[model samples]
Target: MLNIVLFGPPGAGKGTQSQKLIARYNLVHLSTGDLLRAQIAQGTELGLRAKKLMDEGLLVPDEVVIGMINSALNDNKQAAGFIFDGFPRTVPQAESLDALLAQHDTKVSCMVALEVAEEELVTRLLERGKTSGRPDDQNEEKIRKRVTVYNTETAQVAGYYAQQQKFHALNGIGAIDSIFAQICGIIDQHQPATSESSRQATDEVKA
Candidate 1:
């Protein structure tokens, strides 16, 4: 399995690029944020617990987040691999994720971090806020705080992957297609099965 961790700060185009990578790699889309929201909407026990912690402004414990990811993996047992987006936000989480995937006899192939400037992230989030109506994105203070938290806390996750020789920091500025091509280049280097399909997908996108 060619599992990948699509790492980046918020507003770094992870969501957008994930769609293309998924198509190119034939990977399952595992976004912990989306999974939690779905669980919360369903009012599941896990969801209630997560909601309570979220309401209290406390970070949801790693176990809860891991459980959600576990369920997702269970649900997609036959997936070629997974594009992990928005989970493993800390070193502990990264360790936990590794343990979980190890149980399945696989591991993260690479961590493609979209390295974008803080100013660019802020600008992107603020612009997205205008129409996204996401309160977190609307406020510059909140945006900056989020970025700060990511840089201080979440960014360290890269080190964990780096130690494994699976970390990459791809430039995230410039035209979306150009950046995506760079990302695809990294993925291709690591995931051999994706090479041919990736080229096909890129051609399709360009066409």
Candidate 2:
């Protein structure tokens, strides 16, 4: 399986790029944020728990989120792979994920970090607040806090993957298509040559 983790702070266009990658690669989009929101929307026990934390802009407890991911992976073992967004936010979560995938005889093949300027994130959040009316985005104080939390907590996972030579940084600025191309280029460079289909997919995008 072509396991991929998409890492970025809030408002960095992770979702937008993920959707494009999923469609092009036939990968499952396992966005933790969406999974939790769906659970909340459905009033599932897990969703209700996550909702309380999310409404306060707090990180959901690692175990609860990891449980959700494990269940998803178990149920979707037949999938081509997964694009994990908004997940593995802490070192422990990342470690747990590695173990889970290892049990399946697969591992995270790539960890793509979307490198966006803090000012860009702030600007994007403010714009999102205007259009989406999301309470978290509206408060500059809260936005700053979230960004700080992301840097302090989630950013370290990049180093963990870097040590394994599985981390790649992609510029999060530029036209959406251009940014996607850049990401595809990184993946293409790393995917094994024996994987002809993945190579073709990347080439098609580059073309």
Candidate 3:
């Protein structure tokens, strides 16, 4: 499976790019934020807990996030691959993800990080807040705090992947298509030859 870890700070356009990548690569979208929200919507015990943390702009516990990802992986056994968004934020979480994927005999194909300036992120998020109805987005202080947390606590995860030569960073300030093309180039380089053949066969069958 061609699993990818999509890395970026908030307002880096990960959600938009993930949709495009999913369409192009037939990857399942495993967004931790979405998963947490689903639990919240269901009013589960975990949801209640996660909601409290999230309302305060705090991250949910790693174990809870990993469990949700494990369930997603199990549910999508036939997926072409999975694009992980808003996950594996800390180095330990990255380690856990590596172990989890190992149990499935597949590893992260690559980690693609989007590089955006903090000011740009703040502006974009504030604009999104006008329509997104997300309190975190509307509050500039919360947005900056989140970015700082990522930098101080989560940025090291990139080094973990880089040591394995499976990390790619792209400029996130350009046109959406331009940035996507850069990401696709990196993915094409890492994609296994067998996966190409399998995709072709699947396409042929569809045709």
- lDDT per model vs. reference: 0.84, 0.86, 0.88
RMSD (Cα, Å) for all candidates, in order, is 2.5, 1.7, 3.8
Candidate 2, superposed: residue stretches over 4 Å from native: 193-198
- Per-residue accuracy of model 2 over 1-207 as CA lDDT, tens digit each: 788899999998999999998987788999998888788889998888887777677899888888888889889889988899988898999999999899888889898988899999999999999987567889888888889999998899999999999999888888998888888887665566426786777777777
In model 1, the worst 10-residue window by lDDT is 50-59
lDDT-best of 1 and 2: 2
Worst 10 residues of 3 by lDDT: 198-207
Q: Rank the models by lDDT, top first.
A: 3, 2, 1
User: Candidate 1 local accuracy as lDDT?
Assistant: 0.84
Model 1 Cα RMSD, Å? Answer: 2.5
| Cα distance off (Å), candidate 1, residue 159 | 1.1
Clashing pairs in 1: none
lDDT of 1 by residue, 1-207 (tens): 988899898899999999888877789999876787677889998888876754443467888889878988899899999999977899999999999999988888899998899999999999998997556778887788778878899999999999999999988777887777777777777876655656777666555
